[model samples]
Target: MELEKKKIVEHNDLIMSSAKMDTVPLKFFELAVSEIDTFNPPKDNTIYLSKRDMFKFLNAKDNDNDKYHRFKQAISKMQKQAFFEIREEKGKGFVFRNIVPIPYVEWKSYSDEVKIRFDVEIMPYLTELKTNFTQFALTDIQGLNSKHSIIIYKWLNMNYNQFEYYKKNGNRDGQQLYNLCNPIIEVDELRWLTNTQKEYVGRFTNFEIYVIKKPIKEINKYTRFNVSYDKIREGRKITKIQFHISLKGEKTIENSSSKPKKVVTLADAQQSPYSQLLIGAFLLQISDVQDEKLMLSLAAKIYPKYDEFVEKYSLDILKKHLEYVKAHSTNIKDLVTYLDNALENYQKRLVGQEKDNKESKPKNRKKGVIQKEKIPDYISNPGKNKLTQKGIEDSKAADELLAKINGDLK
Candidate 1:
């Protein structure tokens, strides 16, 4: 089936922006602790490692049934509890958190991929903030048990500037490192939440610096893409500011000059026909420069209108990819039409050969009758000689009668 190409247009008023936070979530931060009692008693507590003699470890030889049985009890225990939750705040967007038992062995494993799969399945509904927390907190899990504090500290330092570095590289590996450690089952690390941090007024345990992004105008700084729109309220006029932003994810913001920010729209950027032609070029730059998966995520944020922004580039790229596949095919057999023609030709050839064989073979006949194939001629002509002799006698008698009558008359 063929799908029609969709057209995408950018409005003059709309602008694009992206942003990311540097601080790790409190839940994850609490998880990173040295309390050994939270996990199963390890024979050697000095080094962080999974229990070597684990009753069941997934291996290549295990069948699906065996594997399912091994984890069945633990998985069942988790279903009863609400492992994840999403709640709303009045001004702020939302909150998502996971509350589950975390097995110690699972957390100690080095595989980041396994950790993330567990996280997504168990804690399915995190708000945008919680989502960011899951992504950022993955690396901190190791900090809990590692002996080298400096190395862990250094890693966090490097992580702080990851957004900017990722921007330049246009890759997701760095961002994914943290997300890789999110898990479905709560590990012993999470139990530390109850033990290590004492409750104050039953809320607000430890204070850590969380880097948040607010409007430049709020701080009285000049932002490049800020604009005002007029709204009428009770016959009075009110103006609101809109900003177009791209999150660099850098620890630092570069533009220091404080001017009253002006908002620049795609229409303002491309007022002329020449600039409109360049809009596609501009989109290409943004798509190429940004992380592809994050772009899809951001697309989800501004859906419907963003759908147009996404449909234009995404569909065309998909079409071009499919076209490449079609163009590169080397033979007719690669197509459906060719396969049909080949099958018809094969059937015709078989029928023609059978007809030719029948025409070339000799036919046998006996006793003025065509003999059936595979029967001996003697068997088919049984008593045929006796019948011939009787026919001759009859003919002689008739001839004599006719001759005698003719003589008498003369």
Candidate 2:
């Protein structure tokens, strides 16, 4: 089925605005947002959305009576709800503004499309966003099953995007680094944004269990980053939240361009042995190298170069490149040789792509207009590896080398 453009960008303020919604309505709202042309939204403010598209986007069975009923109910809920409240500073105080996203909904009996109009007042927030915007792929949250999950994903993604932008721009000052790298939000404010204030009010543990934990788990499982949070307590009561977000399989490198330095401290050396085992398991699972003995034997050979792989590309990217190799090559006699060739080809492709992008850009374009490099989706997780390890044994030499490697990282 043909899909609408797979991405949407909204002002960060709007994304971080407070909203209370159920799963279906939130999904519907996202579908409408996806249809919006953020750069040049239609002057009419009314957008026609296909029911078939909604069903497909939600992965629901189309033409089912119960599903259709739920869809209609969601639309009704959206129309009656104040879905967004934009807060801005006034001269002496603050002013709170609200918008009913779908002011009107029109549908005909037995029709496959629904017509809805956006509030004209909401236009400024949705269009002409030059800075402080959150851009994400629609597919990223389509599979999410909770409204809280969707909200948390967008919030975390906005922070991730900000972190990347600051890192790219060389904003390394201590205060700027802290602000950009760590997004510490008030617990009550987060509750307002996620619409859990009433349900989990004054009960941090319950809130964490029902609202925070599940969404973080789902976001990490289905999206690009692994998310965890630390609570800040005031007088034995939680008052703020500090989220720790990181892309899986890639060491959080300080400098974007510099090669990842090896661990150089005793404390850093502790992770080396674990890293080797994880990499070995990842290789075995992805390559379908059946013989545990053979896999361990080859892993031993590849162990010394583990840092090289981590330094050059993320584990996810390497896995994708390897999968590409597996799909394209008909004969793979030697697993080690095949892996080596795959890694080489992958690097070559990246270099070529970067060259092509630069050449395609206008030579006389404005200075400092750097094209943002898109980070690839999280393709696989090392922890998810299900390789059989009946006969495999750790190599003492590999362990020693990895310990040295870890120490070098410091």
Candidate 3:
């Protein structure tokens, strides 16, 4: 019933879309999806599942026979009420698709297994990913007690995966890169993401408490993401929300993909503009790149952690930190060690650096309201902008980390 590390890979669009369901049905859907051979899906649009395992997954007890009846009720509701409400911007206007995912679920009382068919409308989103997708272990949400936890976890996973992909690929820089980790959203957009457009409409306090804080708290406790949100204000009124997301302990865990991690070589990064500027700037301060032997030696030292450096610091930030590093230290033996140490030290002071702008700004929703800084359009309306082939190839960057837990090559 509680599948062992069963991994689910979903397109980024579906992950970001709204799915409002109770914990039991969500688990049931995931379990069934975990069974699909996505590459070679069922020809007849059907899949068979273990009824006993499904019941066990539902935590139905041998003595508690009422759950079977309850299961029927849930299935009936699923047919009539449970559906994925997907809305995406289509050209100048937006398109909405309501998909009843599993309409055909059948089982005989004598049979140990259940047979079900996925709606053809929902197949492409679930299988055969084109560019963007997210892969995570079902066990990651196994302990989650709420639907919000499940939903937000996937959303965070999608963003974090993109963040890492950019960090590793060395294409993203400036505001474009930083917003991946800390995204700003309109209150309405946040409501859409959580499927709570109706719940806390005018009640700002209640909205902050129930919709924003509680889900984030649950996610922080159960998931790998340590996320916190703050209300942002324009003049006196709070209109937007900013979520600061980072890994709980160390760097975020890699996705549950079976492919080997794709390493971005110094050679590979030479073609990237972000890396070119970074390498050029750092070299101007520490060493000259003209010397081939020394450059090769230095590349060997830094290539291992070049991604880490790129991920954390934009060129502007890195340049400032480099100036500080040069003024304080002299005769550095290990360039990688010195730079990394400086990065950590520099990162620590970044919060304090913001204090320089202490004009005391605004949020009625949360206790800590931040002043309205410039908002990146990407965070406000994600998946709305189409990128060229060279623009932040996250799907290409994270090819290896997209493996399934069961070692299915997605």
Candidate 4:
């Protein structure tokens, strides 16, 4: 049996239609809302509220209120006019079907709004590609009272170009089609490609593509297939390597456990004076020692023989070392000690008047407490009513006027 649609009822001339259906729950809506920009009226699909959210909003003593009943009443009314259908699949959560009666509008037409979310496992691909999201206003919509199904479908179609671009560039970009024809694709693991990317690529028949990473130095390793000439392109290899460096973090490497680790010893490191300078520079960059004295102390620990090296080098080389240290790392413990002593001596030079001014900092006042007028008159006038004659008269007049106004208005 078809679920009945309700008719729009007249309530203060407002066309109100809504539905009550089991949803994915408030947790899903909370997660989605924080990430998605909500739809305004006329350009929006049916508003989805999780069953949990509805319960909270209604504030029923024990979830026994007729709040959901009111929603069903509205949807039924709207359905009678063929505006839309509030539907729930047997196992799937609630879905408000777009039933807006517009000519040239086919329900089976393609959707443009492809929303895909990923778990943390897919963060590498999502971050690398740098996806762009564009939103459009459904200006084609007529009225907020009218069904916005057509507007929503239009919205879906409008946003689909991005996935289409991903489709055309599938082969070169490592996008492939799945066996199932549905616009969604799931893989055990996908790097440099989103689940959404999989959806676009997985719509093919026999074509399959895979991602291959190569070092920048090894660009000519693979062969390319030419479509027009049916031969490889002259001097151009298919397996070209592209190097990508990330400031956020390293790119994901599959089979990480199998890779060999490279370790260097302190003696091996000390063999290269340049390497020592690099290490010192790196340490200075990483350290949180703000005091120059602390930095000099750290430098002393890092290079106990720095002073001895200075005696062996020429004046020019010594200057170069200082320059390299300054350029590479700012380990400035010695500088901080000098600055601190200088600041203390400077402060000692201040006059008594200056010290008094420095000590006498202004106090921030509380809003009402510091105001003279706001302090209650009870403290000053113990005998008086504290309420002035004007106040009593005003109160009496307001009471009398309110009674007269209520009588007249009614």
Candidate 5:
């Protein structure tokens, strides 16, 4: 598929604020907004996208059932999540205004399309762009696998471009070699932005592992900037995060004109001969399947041991080991220890099975023939909790209350 140019403009305040969104919905929003006529947004403020175009943009499967389900799910999430707009007051400190980007999303089973209307309140920030607005190409973020990476890339790009503009206009000091903009954000604020505060609360290590490290790595790898951060602590506790941003190369103008040379997907990786082993390594490192950073780090760690693991175990066996660990382990605090334990358990089970097979063989059987019984498929995921309809509604209600409480506290 040929990559298309999609551009979005937002106020710097909104760009710099805390907004939590999922990968799919965020991508949909970008695609939808790109369709809007920026100069003259429809008077009704509604944006439309056909089912075909949405699927194309997402690089999703063409199967109707899967596409429709995913589309609705993304819309539901976007409707529920709130975006915080940061504002500076004259007398008071910074204030946060809660705004939902799209208040209404409508789709019908009979129709082959979707409709999303920008909330009237959020229109001004999105539409007019005389000043204090950041414009970025959507293609620059297409390669990103996480929402946080996309957000950070945009934030850094905005600031970096502005820094360059200022320097060229003589607004910046002539002696300045490189632009260094440090945005000091509270810990809670960062969590809110990444949508992991609730899941990672009281566990900064998990947050660091999932939110901070991985996204920075992805941004540095896929985008045009190099990002790093310094933790600002408060007497042994990390209270704030100061992100240090700079362009990747010596080129002042960020270029995103060319398409990605290769686009790798999980499905493509799984089909490769060596990728199965890599996937097994990933499963070992993943504390939460949703955390992409852990998966990436796992692959990096297991690269040296690939041959050793491949020689000892087949891909199917390694996958079984992963499934067993995922189903049995409740919490993974240390990934290294967990992987070691998992490997030990796999070896023990293999030895036990071999012994049982040897004992069961008939006395008249061939001298060196070893009959190995096939391992059965895991029939159930015992540890997996199924969410009921009521439970889902209750959870959403609770999230709304929590968001309100957070807003009030601010």
Candidate 6:
């Protein structure tokens, strides 16, 4: 299914603005923002949004289950919590703190429509932006699970959008291209970006891992940008960071001669077997940046032994494990790690199941077991070794279907 391309427009200053928001509320806020008509901004702060639309964007289908309650909690939190800090300044006379971006909401259990209001203070930032605004597809962040990743992505978007604007206005030069990287952001600024100045205080290592490294990994892996950074140090202590950014699968400072990779959309996933497993297993979803980079990252390592993988493993084995992963995903903190373990366990089960099936079979059949040489043809499909000798004698259409899948992989 094609997801609606929800474009969000925010003033560059608003993009620079940082706030303390949990991931769910932030997601809810953005989804609501997408509903507003930014060009002709609403006279009133109210926006009517659909619960079905937001749920569909996130692929929240259940095996008969529970995301709506969390959605309710997020809406509740959005109304109660105030932003701790906002970096955007009007005239630099004073700074404001404890601001609420979306201060009120009203909804009914019977209706799918949600009525939410943006704080009147934020109206100027959202409306009638002829200049100094950032626009991007909401899908760029649809899969991002981290609140920090969302904030950092906005930071990257601000500079990158500026770079694109300059290039479009016929200012493409080495110096002009330099606009892609924002100036060195201090550690405090990083915390401001994540709204975690109080929490990660004094624990630089933990902050660096959770607040910096991990979010960057998600941003680079999932978004259109490939971001890198260089740290400025105060003797032994890391003091500041300057980011380097480029389009994913595109030419970069390091590889200017390299060609970009073809970005595969969800529609394209239907064709490639590797993509099918990756998408089907919910390991990755492709909305931006082509290539198989994200698709093949964690799952690919175990997903394949390459072409030999196609012959050895089938989609059924992977799907079984993926379903298991989905069931317990809340408990699985690191999905890549958990998915790797799940795949490994499934492989062992398949091996053991085939062994037991082999032993449980009657060796001498009246119709006879397929000859050793014919084994390859009968079982030439994906999950190649799965067909037992006796089953091979009984199987015809199933054998052909499996053979077709194996052949398609070639």
Against the true structure, whose TM-score is highest? 2
TM-score of each: 0.18, 0.59, 0.57, 0.15, 0.54, 0.58
Task: Quote the lDDT for 75 in model 4.
Answer: 37
**How would the candidate models be sorted by lDDT, starting from the highest?**
2, 6, 3, 5, 4, 1
- Runs off by more than 4 Å, candidate 3: 59-64, 251-410
Question: Which of 1 and 3 is ahead in lDDT?
Answer: 3
For residues 255-323, write the lDDT of model 6, one tens digit per residue: 343222222332233245654444433444443113344444443454444334336765444444454
> Local distance difference test, per candidate?
0.27, 0.67, 0.64, 0.28, 0.63, 0.65
lDDT of 1 by residue, 30-72 (tens): 2222222222422232213122211112221434445434443
Give the poorly placed runs of model 2, Cα more than 4 Å off.
Answer: 1-5, 172-175, 252-410
Task: Assess candidate 2 and give its TM-score to the true structure.
Answer: 0.59
Mind sharing the TM-score for model 4? Answer: 0.15
The lDDT leader among the candidates is 2
Candidate 1 wrongly placed segments (more than 4 Å): 1-49, 52-84, 87-140, 145-162, 169-198, 201-410
What clash pairs does model 5 have? Answer: none
Better of 3 and 6 by lDDT: 6
Off by over 4 Å in 5: 1-3, 63-65, 81-91, 107-112, 174-188, 232-235, 251-410
The TM-score of predicted model 1 comes to 0.18
Per-residue lDDT of model 4, residues 1-410, tens digit only: 10011111111101111211112121122222223322222122222324443333324345576755653443344334323222334565644343322111111115322132322221221122223332222221111111222221222222233334454666422222111111121122221121123333542221122222111111112111100101111122221121111111333122343231222232222333432332332322312232334444434343334434445433333333433334433445554344334324433433343455556644663321111122122112336647566545644654564444334323
> Candidate 6, overall lDDT?
0.65
User: What ordering of candidates by TM-score runs from best to worst?
Assistant: 2, 6, 3, 5, 1, 4
- lDDT of candidate 5 over 186-242, digit per residue (tens): 777677666665776676887887778888899888777777887766434787776
Superior candidate under lDDT, 2 versus 5: 2
